[model samples]
Target: MATIKDVARSAGVSTATVSAVLNDSAYVSPPLRARVLAAIRDLNYSPSLAAQNLKRGRSQLIALVVADLANPFFSRVVWAAEAAVAAWGYSLVVFNSDEKPEAEQRILSRVRMLSCDGVLLVPVGDSTKHLQRDPDEKPLPTVLFGRTVEDDKSDTITIDNISAGRQATEYLLDLGHTRVGSITGPLHLTTGRGRLDGMLAAMKSRGLAPEPRDVRSGEFREDAAYSVARSLLEQQDRPTALYVASGLMALGAMRAIADLGLRCPVDISIASTDTIPGIGGLRPRLTRTEHPLVDMTNEAVRLLVDRIRRGGEVEQRNIVFQPSLVVGDSCAPVGLR
Candidate 1:
């Protein structure tokens, strides 16, 4: 109800003086500043964030776009990115695309309207043409998190998913499981394609080839993965070991295994590329590759902020973090469990 003009009138000071005192843009006498503060409290005046941002020429807001917020891995990324951005005196707004390119495009259009200072985007598949700006237009400061697009001109932060996939598959192979199957993410996305490629490469290294039917697309959804995994497990020539591309998919496959009245490692071993918080407490701890969540988030935020500050003057950076393997109870040597 109260405006800056009302505060200025109540404090017997010019509106410019009140503005200077509130924004700290210019030095005001201590007594005048005290009077302005007192008048602001008395008037219950609250500054308009839009007006403030207009005056400062910045919103001090960052947009984080993720494929699936329901996925714990993205949740961890949101948590870390929020903390890091808050420490830098900015706020974060999160958007979920549900792994759809059209949804991602809609979100980006909304983000453009918001005048966000920067963006951290985990792209959906390879559809990033919407992110490309005209040559004459100044590009939005953006950091691509987790996924990359072809001919990408923005900074990127991601784990080595290919290596992670290979490690998970190779671990099962080393344990003497020749018949290995996989539930892969959507192959349109690099995360899905890269991990599956790694798994296949690992299989090829040992002169082994998985049957075409053994690999199914989970589409990065738990329910889809559940169905795919259940079908895989129902086959007469089921794989002795299974490799999952993501933690969420792994959980689904585990549930499918339970529903089938089968035991992990005893009936069929399992390994995966990622794990979320609390995954360690699962009945049979998942054997998987772990991402540097904290480090990746910190770097993503830092890079976005730097890009926001430096704009086009900064060089684009592509940062890839290595994944670490955590062996757990879910995997066992073939015929030994």
Candidate 2:
């Protein structure tokens, strides 16, 4: 609880001399420096780093707001972001909105109150209005990660969702599956809508379309996907293949398929857009389009840091990374096995 003044008084020196020794900003005789160091140790005095950062108009903190922390996909994002932020000399503050816009609003408000230097956000809403703290003050430095919204100012780092969908569906089609279905995320988000659109487009290109009942929204949730996939597979004329929109949802679907006593690539084939931490170990490893999650997170942090340092003078940039198809035994050609 000792202040700099207390250290200076104990050291028998002016507070300025104490500060000089602490900051190493000015020359101090060895004797005076020794006294100051001794006083600091005896008094258990520690300077306030938050106060010092504030005086320089920085918090040395960056906020990373993800839509769903329970999802392993976002957990990977957090891991990558932590290292990327630290490499730039900033600590990371994490928040999970759980895919709720109200929670997103509150989290962004808290970020503003904490005066975070920048934000890397996985947007949960259709707009970025919450990022603007005050009409008079400038907008916070922000980079939207893995998603985009109705914001023109912030930079965006995203995967080609449409390509992800198209690639997965094309893989299924190439394997000779005629009746292909999909379990998708909420259609309101770009990740959901774009992937579904790509699936439909790929089907249309092959002169085919899914039945209205064949596609279901899984809300990007494991439990929801489990229920939906169970119901879809219970039908008498279910599709032979399913294109799951996300890795988490795919896990749920896989579990559902097992619960129903169905085997992958035999009774039904499954392909998905993203991959999670343990997905590689699944029997008949998932046939999916994999996003560069670590690279995307690093790029998002990089853009946010650039915006924080350069302010609005820098041009807004939207960077899109492509997904690569990783083939595995989860999918098999129809009538071949």
- Give candidate 2's TM-score: 0.91
* Top TM-score model: 1
- Per lDDT, the best of the predicted structures is 2
lDDT of 1 by residue, 1-337 (tens): 8989999999999999999998799999999999999999998999988988888778989999999999988899989999999999999999999888899989988888898889999998575678754667778888999989888889999888889989999999999999999999988788999999999999999999888889998678678889999999999878999999999889999999999998998999999987787787898989999888899999999999999998888888999999988999899899875
Q: For residue 87, give model 1's deviation from the true position in Å.
A: 2.1
In model 1, the worst 10-residue window by lDDT is 125-134
lDDT of 2 by residue, 167-254 (tens): 9999999999989999999999999999999999999999999998999996888899999999999999999999999999999999
RMSD of each: 1.9, 2.4
The regions of model 2 sitting more than 4 angstroms off are 1-46
- Could you tell me how far off, in angstroms, the CA of residue 233 lies in candidate 2 after the best superposition? 1.0
For all candidates, the clash counts are: 0, 0
> Per-model C-alpha lDDT, please?
0.91, 0.93
Off by over 4 Å in 1: none
